[model samples]
Target: MTDHADLLELAVEVAREAAALVTERRRAGVEVADTKTSPTDVVTEVDHAAEELIRDRLLAARPDDGIVGEEGDDTPSTSGVTWVVDPIDGTVNFLYGIPQYAISIAAKEGDEVVAGVVLDVTKGEAFTATRGGGAHLDGRPVRVRDVVPLEHRLVITGFSYQRETRVKQAAAIARLLGRVRDVRRLGSAALDLCYVACGRADAYVEEGLNEWDLAAGGLVVEEAGGRWAQRPGVGGKRLVLASPAGGFDDFVAAVEGCGFTAS
Candidate 1:
């Protein structure tokens, strides 16, 4: 078995490398090659290039390991380890020159994630964690905020690119807004989870997220003394909610009241 620490290192390294590639490409300006699911769901050449760079580095380092990436076909592995990667977590933010985009990577052993990292591309902040080890931001340990009332909590969330889903999601948000301190849509699920982990936000909830979007940041939140739940959403899709230990139940209930099912 590979050491969790080593896996964490690999995740951080690969995520950072991919983030650098994305940053350079954005600096050079790239064209949108296509859209997925909807016209609003955009994809650029940089996304593919970054994913390829990560795949190449990971396979070269551990040929037996598998890879599941957002922009590429899944590769199976003979080894128990499989890497989940999102080369660019916030393509819209990246396209708009927003600094909230990220490169996320995680190492899963069987069904468990053993290590993970999320690199804030523009900020150059690396958030990392290993199972049983605490989460960190730029080498300093981080923890979720302590007890806070549901109404006082600031929540971060994201919307689906599909207009229909976004409409439903926006309606849900409207109902949630008056119940919480405020709501923020950061356009990046990975960073939203990390913000919850590092006390930047009191909670995060969203649907229509892929495994790669949550895998890395989820571990960070868990290790930072937070709890999360993934429940069945409309159309069998999953909705994720993460909050500090003391505020989790209330946060879950608040979102559930807005019609987000909790499992």
Candidate 2:
């Protein structure tokens, strides 16, 4: 067994419990929602509520660990352990009853992610990984697909809600649409990366993601034999995620033609 696996066990437990709370509230009925930064960027009560639940449980379990979450802040410490969280990764979808959101939690040592979990609240799917141990979906080990040819790939991507960012992403989407099997914008970067890890979606690209949004999902993709890079996008720290063993070169070539590079 590995150290991350132990941490993963605890993370999985916390993430699933948070997911159940989200699903239960979603089923009851949603109240109206509002924007966070812009009108197009939506957030629901469930996001903050779930964050509170996950934050409390995780901090209680390990009081010394630092936390960085979408809804709140926990200062960095010298303890070398920090939990990065995006309690509800697709709050817009969750609010609209679209059923594609997730609870993303990650535990990191220093600057590296050691263990992480992404819980698909609507589907009851849990995707997890531990550094150097490999990635898994519901206890079954998973890996990236071995397909070649960008034209044959199913890529997933998303845009920032900001106006200028959305415009650039739209152009990029138009550039890639004609050359691939298909492109999807699922609205949940966490689930999108899990899709890349489990080989459901061959690749995922995103911009305007904070550290908490990409940390866990990035580790899952890496442990599953995938690749991850930070590309310049809306805010210049957007994440470009794919499989290193699964088509890294081609993914890079395809994406670079559109002028995205690490920020």
Candidate 3:
């Protein structure tokens, strides 16, 4: 039997180690390693270094498990388990010396994510979850906040690096602002989901999130007694959505009405 807790433990361990390396490197200064999708969509030397560190540690721990990382090529699994890694989600924030980036890691058996961790590089906060186990922050159990009314729900989101997508997202946000309590654009998707998981926010929705970006944090949100979903949206990208269960259906309706998912 695949032990989900075992996977979660390994993910948390590797993620913390990678976070340390990232923090150490950021202190030395940052250099742009490359860009993806758009010029503003950057990858840094620290990003590559951290990802390699994570991949190496994870593979050393579980030799037969596959790896899918933001900064490296995919490694197929013989053990039926794959690790999804985002070496530094919110790399732009990291480059700007903002304290919101994270090391995200998740383990999946087949297509189902079984375990996950999102370690905040700057805050030293660890958000973790397993398939049946509940979500936790710093080892204490956590849950999403009770239902907030539509006009008072604090919605969080991210914009695409591409200008066209950002333009559309802005339009959606403009429409959404009047209906919700407020909105925040926090560069990191992983942390945004975790924020909702721990009741720091009431909901999160974003389009164009890659699998590595969503895997660990999405699992955390689900395990926290919250709800999430994804569907085709503008540019054919997946419009990821999440909220406390009480507000999810209404939040989705609001998101759609505001053109968040309009093609």
Candidate 4:
């Protein structure tokens, strides 16, 4: 538990630092803009600056750990401790002046995530989790809501950047929206899953996420007594679904109709 606690501390510190960098850059102004894959996928000066800030802090503290970042190259780690980062989880939101984005960081031992942090820079809110120690929001313990019924369930989701995939993803959301109490596309997956962890959102699902995007928030959701899985009858890449333990079955049922890739 001590090591886990220490890891959480380190991740929290690194995330906060990254968040500060994001804040400073966002407030100062985003001068340089670049697009990836499509016009919708974006990277700005802040994302690169924030990732460098995170890499410096994390690698300096634990030099042996490998680091993988959304905005940077993968540096393979020999120590089996890999630190994954999404410097700006919602760059589109950030660039457009939306405050729903977050900074995500997680450390994995082998394939298992041992520590995680999601910092909502706009709100100065932080969520942290360790493998067995449970999840926390601003240093206080937090857990998922126990919402169960479809009529009462609130869900959050994200769409893919690929045009064809986005159309399919939209149709699935349309069906789900009519069945659920309500649905939202928050743009920031890290904050959305953190919301699920702390009972702010009942459940969340998304497709085509890289490790950096889901690592911290997924672990946080698990630590907060939520369950994680691929949509029923769907493979790992189809959709990553997560909900409170009490709402798991309903969530699975709601997403059962999604068009997903085969395992």
lDDT per model vs. reference: 0.90, 0.82, 0.93, 0.84
Which residue pairs of candidate 2 clash?
A: 226-243, 226-244, 227-242, 227-244
Candidate 1 Cα errors over 4 Å, as ranges? none
User: TM per model?
Assistant: 0.97, 0.93, 0.98, 0.93
For model 3, the local distance difference test gives 0.93
Error (Å) of candidate 4 at residue 22 is 1.1
For lDDT, candidate 1 versus 4, the one ahead is: 1
The window of 10 residues in a row where model 4 has the poorest summed lDDT is 230-239
Whole-structure CA lDDT of model 4: 0.84
Tell me the deviation in Å of residue 28 in model 3. 0.3
Candidate 3 structure quality by residue, lDDT tens digits, 1-263: 67999998888888889999999999999999999999999999999999899999999989999999989999999999999999999999999999999999999999999999999999999999999899999999999999989999999999888898889889999999999999998899999999999999999999999999999999999999999999777756889999998889999999999998865
Clashes of each: 0, 4, 0, 0
Per-residue error (Å), model 1, residue 247: 1.3
Q: Which stretches of candidate 3 lie above 4 Å from their native place?
A: none
Ordering by lDDT: 3, 1, 4, 2
Q: Give the TM-score of candidate 4.
A: 0.93
Which pairs of residues clash in candidate 4, taking residues 3 or more apart in a chain or in different chains? none
* Candidate 1: RMSD to truth: 1.4
Per-residue CA lDDT of model 2 for 119-172, tens digit only, reads 988788899998888899998999888766888889998887888767777877
